[model samples]
Target: MMDNKTLEKKAIAAECFVEVPFFDLDPMNIVWHGNYVKYFEQARCELLRKIDYDYPQMKESGYYWPIIDMRLKYIKPANFGEKLLCIATFKECENRLKINYLIQSAESGEKLCKGYTVQVAVTTSDFEMQLVSPDILKQRLTDYISGLS
Candidate 1:
C-alpha cells in the first residue's frame, strides 16, 4: 500500500490566504455562505496554475473545463477581518477533473469550510463533452507529479 508520503507526492496541492472583508459578510457579521465558492475558485486556480493547467492553458489546448458539479459544507463561520488558509488538492483527472478544497482559520487552524468541484472536458469549438481527458492535461499532471518525487 502507498504511504502518506507517496500519496502526497502524487497529488498536486496549493494554498492561498484570504482575509474576510466586510463586503463578504452578511448582516449577521459572518461570511455569507455563497462567498465560499469564490474562495474555492481562488485555491483551485492556484493549484491548476502550479500544474500549468489553468483555464487559459486549457483553452489553448482546445478544451474547456466547465464546472459540472460542486458541493460545500460549512464547519464554522468566518468573521470579518479573520484570516483563512484555503487549500486546493487535485483529487482525480482521468475522465474528469476533480479538486477538493479546505478552508481553515490561519491563526487557529480550525476548519471553516470544505468542498469539491468537478469539471468535465469539452471541445472548445463544438462544445461536445469529452469522454476522455485530453493528452495535454495528462502530460501536465504527469510532469507536476514527477517533480514532487
Candidate 2:
C-alpha cells in the first residue's frame, strides 16, 4: 500500500472546483457514484500540469503512460448545486506515477471521496513497457520548479 506521506513528496498538489449539476444526480437527487471518477481524473490532470508532465507532453516525449491500476472510495453523497473541491497529489513515480485524490465539499471542507491511479510508461514507437520512467519526466519536473523558484 502507498503511504500518504510518501505520496506527498512527489505530489504536485492541486485543487479544482466542480458543481453538481442536476443531470448528474440520481433518483435521490444525490450525485451518482460513477461521477466521482471523472472528478478525480480532472484534478489528477491538473496536478500533472503543475509538473509540466501532462498527457500531451508525455506523448511528445516518445512514451505513452497508461493507467494500469485505480481505486476509489466514497464517504458521503453530494446533492445538486453542491460544489466540490477536488485535491490531487502524486503518491509515487520512481517506477510509475501513482496519484492519490480526494474530493471534498468546497464549503464545509468535508471529505466526500478518495481515490488513486497508477500509470506505467510505454514506448510510443513500439508500445514496449518500461520498467522505469523516462528521463523526460524528471527533467521536466526539475525545470518547472527551477523556473518558478
Residue-level lDDT for 8 in candidate 2? 62
Model 2 lDDT at residue 21: 89
Regions of candidate 2 where Cα sits further than 4 Å from its true position: 1-7
TM-score of 2: 0.88
Flag clash pairs in model 1.
none
The window of 10 residues in a row where model 1 has the poorest summed lDDT is 1-10
Measured with C-alpha atoms, the lDDT of residue 52 in candidate 2 is: 79
By TM-score, who's the top model here?
A: 1
Root-mean-square deviation of candidate 2: 3.3
User: What's the TM-score of each model vs. the native?
Assistant: 0.92, 0.88
- Model 1 agreement with the true structure over 73-143: per-residue lDDT tens digits: 99999999999999999777767888899999999999999999999999999999998777788788778
Model 2: lDDT to the true structure: 0.84
Error of 1 at 32 (Å): 0.4
